[model samples]
Target chain A: MKKNASLTRLFWTSFSISALTFGGGYVIVSLLRKQFVDKHGWMTDDEMLDILAISQSCPGVIAVNATFMAGYRLRGAAGAAAAVIGCIIPPFGIIFGLSFFYTAVKDSPAVRGVFRGLLAGVAAVIADVVVTMTTPVIKAKKVLPIVIMFAAFVANFVFNWNPAFIILFTAALGIALQLARFFRRKMAQGTGDR
Target chain B: MKYLELFWAFFKVGLMSFGGGYAAMPLVQTQIVEELGWINMTDFTDMLAISQMTPGPISINLSTFVGARMGNLLGATAAMLGCIVPSCVIMLILTRLYRKFRTLETVQCVLAVLKPATLSMIAASGGSLFLLSVFGGEPRDLWLAGFDWRAGFDWFAAVIFAVGLVLLRIKRVKVPPVLIMLGAGVLGLVFSVLPAVNG
Candidate 1:
């Protein structure tokens, strides 16, 4: 009974958070920290940080991933399921409703006007993202990462390379760099033994 | 046939949804807009606007919107499934081996390069959307030598874009994104109905 009560709380909490928060990803992080860390004492600060690290590390939508992990920590598999379901309902339901009207009104001139403006706004917002995301890389002062960034821009913008192939190539390159570093450390240790 | 195509496209999107939602935007743009022709650039921008306004992951919001646009309810379900299945499966594996997973140095190495690459992808996607918004044509068309660059540009949209940029520059969350889009939409409504702006 206690467990069931907890599961239900998990569901409602996740549902409310997912329903209320916008901007996705980073937006949910602080909110989750607030609920799980500060409010409920369900998780420690360190655990929330770990969840964040793991969430960002995994290859999925960061919000879903982070919430799922956070839920699992709170309870278990059932908790994860409850939280993810809660998280998805808002997007799925809201989009499902909006899609219908969008198709209907899309051809209307009034809607077209709004859409035209929305398009420009979306572009500016994306530009803001480009600035926010790139600042960290520039701050790091790493040449290789900068070169890779430029190469990627050229590949997509100029050459129209498939993004999948670009990811694969970069991943392979990164692994090779790691391997080289590993061997160099090993050789240094070997010399130190003498 | 289209259902299968939607499934396949979003499935691939799921597989590559690394880094974050923003990184996945370009991949989704490539699959749906550039490659498959499932949606136009204008529609793509609209979808992004909707995603920004709503809650949940941008990736999921996009999948649902695209799927709903393409194939209705069943199609939306198929696309949504394709998007989440990868995350579910990957998370399952990750949860089990998480302790070992943390020790692997290679993931960080990949992320080091992947971060910049993802930034590049966002820029490319943003650039395409920007061109489509301001110039009213394919980006490829814009770059061609003989293209009518002057006539192609939409001055009304250019002004909204400037306003949006100014809104974003407010530094801190004084102006939320949804409001920014709403402000632009208001501009659109007023100007779009006007005599000169072509309703």
Candidate 2:
């Protein structure tokens, strides 16, 4: 529908973008902004960010979902196919190639040493992530969310409950809270009208 | 049979993954590592670390890595296919219902709750990996399972984690994870030579 670019070009654009970026998700989103907004002039920066928000909110790999949406926006289903295929090929190929060597070296003592170190390093990074994630909750100073956060952690870590259930349960509770708040406000407004 | 099982497990991972790449970690731990027993915790975490250095989404990289580990090229293909199908389908459904989908109050509410919830998931996964890597046991096992205390701890790993934490926690510098990991690996190599502990 938009037709700013051909299918092949879209495919290649996605492929090159997917291939080049190291850290996925946010990194890809930034590149998308540059490509679609800066290079091709296909969409405004704000428009691209809106697509990104939807892509992130949806349940999937951000890259695939974004490309699907972007491609659909551009040229419909066929465009989506081309773009996704391009985006997928590089990661699949790169990982597939690395898997062989990793399998061979994995059990070696030296590799084991590296693995241990990598684990600690990853833990540290996740720790940093923990700070990043919790700061907003701390700032909000809402007791319910703080309680929900700890409860979710306990359910998974202590009880060994599946993270999926935790997500679903918390979402349900959150929605209930939102509804209750909505009703409270509505009742308040009704009383004011009287 | 094996390929089908692998595909199904990853499919659920793709479906339940709410937030993004890191959010999928706990799902992978539950599905592939714990349920299916395709790989152990060490391999899972190790592969995750390697994927951090690679150029791809963590889910896809993990699916391909785990699949290739379980079966082969065809198996990897199947697992990947399973993973992507749900994502594509869900997105397609949203695309069709695009007008009303984004504005849905429930969607916003769920996401609001999930933001912190998923972060806890990441923290929990990180804690488990931290346990296995340094302490050689989970909190439950180390505490309730009568696991030996002194024998379970790894000093070098703890030190590496401590140092890396200090370095990584400094948010303004924007240090790359791979750099700290590689440096820690070298430090680990230095400790590996010690007679008693592998570190």
Candidate 3:
């Protein structure tokens, strides 16, 4: 009974966060961190960080991915569904409405001004996210990640290279590094046993 | 013929775009401009600008605009739906599977690698967009003397950006993004109505 209740709470919390947040996946991160990690003590900082990492690698929306992991952690399959629904419902509703009235609302001078202001804010949010995400990269002092970031930036900005290539290349790079590390550990262990 | 192709192409782009709409841009550009020949480079750029100025995700907005251009309202709907379906279905399935393997170390490590890559992709995309915002043909070509500092400054945007930065940095204030967007719209309206001054 206690577990079920907790799962219910997780569902509502996830739903509320997704429903209310406006700027999409990036903005949702801070909110999720606050609610799940700080406010509820549902997940630790390390756990939240781990979830974020997993969400990035997977093939779906980060928010949905994070919610799935979080929900599953708390309450299994049912919990995951609740969280996913929570994350998606708001965006779906908002998008549907926007789609309906988009043509009419788009041309209003007031609306234009708001978007202008919002764009700046969105830029600010993106900057904040970049800073947050870069911390680990700096700590790890992984030259490859930095190089990849810079190269990708240059390629996309200057040459207009496709991002799909960038993502695929980096994913492959990551997998190769992991395999190398695994083999190195195994070799070291074998030598010690001798 | 073209519209159906656009729908399928964008659907593929949408499915492959894991992070979000922005992440989908490079793929969309590659398919539409480089591969399909549906839209030229200049038009694609314009579509991007228009998407930015409008509400909704960049991917959806572009799909709608491009779809409309290709085959009217139905095409727009199809493209938009195509872009969204992949993420939606994927999310649904992942949500179901998430309960079983949420805590594995190997899973954790993979995620660690992906996080940086995702960040890098977003940052790269942002840099690209910044270039377009500043150096795109429209801004450069619109200049009266081919170089007017005041008009080129985009003072309104800059001021809002600066003010927002200060508010965000110092106060730790959490202002709703929608409010800021609305404020900019009002500012634009005011600027638009103001009489032009000849230097």
Candidate 4:
């Protein structure tokens, strides 16, 4: 099929994107948008956002999951495989190579110093992560979401609750709220009909 | 047998880490540090720093490092596969049902809740990491032992942390994070050598 030829192109594109980006999910995402939307004109911004939402909703790395979604959307199962493998291979290979020499390099005083310095930098980046991640939630100005966000933080940091349990509880809470809203809307429609 | 253990451990981490890599840190910490005892606290933090510098998901990068440390190339392969397979399979299945689920009001609400919850988890992870880096990764008992809390703290790290916060958060410096990290590493090298010279 003609799709098969495109699949190889898709794979290499994903691989190059993954290989070049250094900052992780957010960086990779923006690069993906550029290639798929601006350069190739294959996907619209809204479609990309929708795919990103699906990727974030699932459990995997956002990069890998997005690659899978984009690949599947373009050319189906085989395409998905190509894209996922292409994206992951570079990072996997690099990290694998580094692992072999990590012990040797890690033992040096200078290396230890560098890693120690990295600790502060990591802290700063994480602090930014907190700010960026929470900004949208706060801007939404929804009381329930605001409350849930703080509650989750306290439960996690202060109580050391299992993250899985916290996620489950929030999911249940969301479902309950949605169910109640749905029933209320139905009741209102029923009254109008009568 | 060890390879199997590495696979299963990372597999659970892959399946359960909901928000993303940062949110997964706590679970990864517990698994690798507490349960498996594969690495110590210091090494874990070092791995985190290294993983951040690497491309891809932090989880995958970490799995690769941990696996290689345990069993060379074969171990690394196992860990990497374990970390990803669950997600790959789940995504494949979900991709099929995605059209139906995306339209559901319940699914929307669930995602809405998950976004804030996941953000909160990331915040908490940041807090714990800050404490660990500043306090030298000792258990709480050591901190509570007496009034000599300074004994357990790493003042160098604490100072660097404050400087970094000021540079990025308050000054709104447009520097990339990797650059900042590298600068701090340079500072670390200088400081390490300084003590040797002075003492």
Candidate 5:
């Protein structure tokens, strides 16, 4: 009974977070951290970071992935199910409603004006996302990551390259760099032993 | 038939999506806006705004909007399922392995490389959307020729965008995004209704 109640809590918590937080991805991260770590004492900050890492690394929406993992950590399969449903329901319902009414209202001058204004805000938020994401790369001060980052941007913006290709190319590049470092370390060890 | 098409198109989007919600925008744009003709460029921008305003993942929000616009509730369900199923299966496997293999050197290296790349993709995605929202009604040839700089630009949007950047980035204002948008909407409506601007 205690476990079931906790699972119910997990579901509501996940749902509310998913429902309330806008701007997606990183917003979800901060909110989840606050709820699970600071608020509930369910997980440590490090655990939250780890889940975030895994969520970002995997394919699909980061919010959903992160929540599912968090729920899984707390209460296993049932927890995962509850969280995923919670996260999805609000967006689905909202978007479904908007879609239905969009055609009728879209052409209204007031609606158009609102959307136009909203577009500016959206652009600003996205800009913040870029700035926030850029800080880590700048802090790393690694030439390779910086180069990959610029290359990926150029490829998409200028050439209109497929995003999948950019991801694959960068992953392969990462693997190759690791292999080179590994072999170089081995060679240095062999010489030292001699 | 449209349901199947929505499912298939979104399925491809799911398979290709990486980096996170914003990163998925270009892929979704490609599939839905460019390839499938499910939505026009203007509608695409509007959808992005709507998705951002609402809660949850942008990718799923986009999928639901596009699917419903194309074929109603069933279409939304099909597209949403298609968008999520691949990730769901992959993540289920990953959640298990992530517990054990997260410490591996290969994983670390891959993640490190992906970091910058993902950032770049997101920057590009944001750039494209910003471009769209700001320069949306311009002619294709005019935009490509770069001659539309003064003539084609929407000055009202540009002002709002500039003000918004300052408010969020410089002032570090804590205004919720929804409110900012609502404020902009009212301003826009006022501008449009004002005879001075419209005339």
Candidate 6:
């Protein structure tokens, strides 16, 4: 029972993190790192990173995955459920209201202008996020991902290639690389055993 | 044929989305445009542009727009429902289980890969968005190119972008999205009211 209470607190903490973060997942991550990994001593940085990767590959919202992984890490499947719900309820409630009146808001001049202004700010935020995220890849000496990033940028921006194709292709490449590396290690281990 | 399949497809999308709503673009484009064939490439592109120009998360906007396009009001409703349901349900479940495994190392490894991938995907989507915003129509002639760039980079947008960035950097103020959006709308109203700008 004591364990369950603590788990609930962590879930709510994550939920609050998601609910309050202005810029979405990446910002949420920084916040989670501070609150969960640093302040609370809940999870290590590496564990957070791993869950983030899995969440990306998986077929759901990143926030939900983070919540699930954080929860599961703490208390198994049931904890996972609690964190997921906590993260989602706020956004769902907000979006539901927005959806109903979105058309009406669209016609308002004031609303339209604000969005235009927000677009530029959003662009800047995205630029900041890109820089922050790429730091790790730069440090890791992995040129392939960087090259892929540049190629993707040019393909979508200059060549007008379909983004869907680029994503699918790169994901396949990542998976293939992982699998090949696994086989090579296995083969080396087999030789060593022999 | 099956509503459940439709629900699951979107639910999967909603659950894995990270970085932001834009991160879901490639997945959505793949699922709906390529695999499902529910929307054509052209329409999907069009919807993307519309979603960008409008306020709100691109994914939700696209879901609503596409849902309406695909199956009318109900379809829009279904798609929206499909998108939100998984996150809602899952979050509820996780809220209960969060504390026990908070210190687990295994969980962190998966997040590391996902974080970068999600970032890359968002960047990729940003590229697509730039194209949609700037170059979606018939190819502009050389003479028209200058005009488009000049007109498209409106002063209102530029000013707001600059101010927002400064605020973000210096003050570290977290400007609410709603307020920024509303500010833009007010500027538009001002422009509309001004004869010179309106023309």
> Pick by lDDT: which candidate is best?
1
CAPRI band of model 4? Answer: medium
lDDT of 4 by residue, B104-189 (tens): 67878888888788787777767767777787543343335464656657888888888887677754456777777878888888
Fnat, model 5, is 0.73
- Pairs with backbone N, CA or C atoms under 3 Å apart (clashes), candidate 2: none
Query: What ordering of candidates by DockQ runs from best to worst?
Result: 1, 2, 5, 4, 3, 6
Which parts of model 6 have CA positions greater than 4 angstroms off? A1-17, A29-59, A73-75, A135-141, A179-194, B1-22, B26-121, B128-153, B162-196
Give model 3's docking category: acceptable
User: How accurate locally, in lDDT, is each candidate?
Assistant: 0.83, 0.82, 0.61, 0.79, 0.79, 0.58
Estimate, for each residue in A8-74, the C-alpha lDDT of model 6 and write its tens digit: 6866877687666654554565676687777777777877776665444444455555666777777
The C-alpha RMSD of each candidate to the native structure, in angstroms, is 2.2, 2.4, 6.0, 2.9, 2.8, 6.6
Give the winner by lDDT: 2 or 4. 2
Candidate 5's residue-wise lDDT over B8-112, tens digit each?
888777766676677778788767776768788778878888888788888889999998988889999999888887777777887778766567888888888
TM-score of each: 0.94, 0.92, 0.67, 0.89, 0.89, 0.64
lDDT, candidate 2, at B114: 80
lDDT of 4 at A31: 85
lDDT of 4 by residue, A27-109 (tens): 88778878877777767787778777777777767788788888887878998899889888988899888876778788788
Q: What is the interface RMSD of each candidate, in Å?
A: 1.3, 1.8, 4.8, 1.9, 2.2, 5.7
Lowest-sum lDDT 10-residue window in model 4 chain A: A1-10
List model 2 lDDT by residue over B106-175, tens digit each.
7887787888888888889989988887888875784586688678788878888888888877878777
For each candidate, the DockQ is 0.75, 0.67, 0.27, 0.63, 0.64, 0.21
- Ranked by lDDT, top first: 1, 2, 4, 5, 3, 6
Per-residue lDDT over B1-199 for candidate 6, one digit per residue giving the tens place of the 0 to 100 score: 4445566667656755644566677668658876789876555654554454443344555676766655555666677667766654654454454443344343343343444555666676554433333333222222254546444445655565556545544535766544554464466567656657642
Model 2 residue A124 CA deviation (Å) reads 1.1
**First chain TM-score, candidate 2:** 0.89
Give the per-residue lDDT of model 2 (tens digit) for A67-113: 88788777789988998888888888998999999988988787787
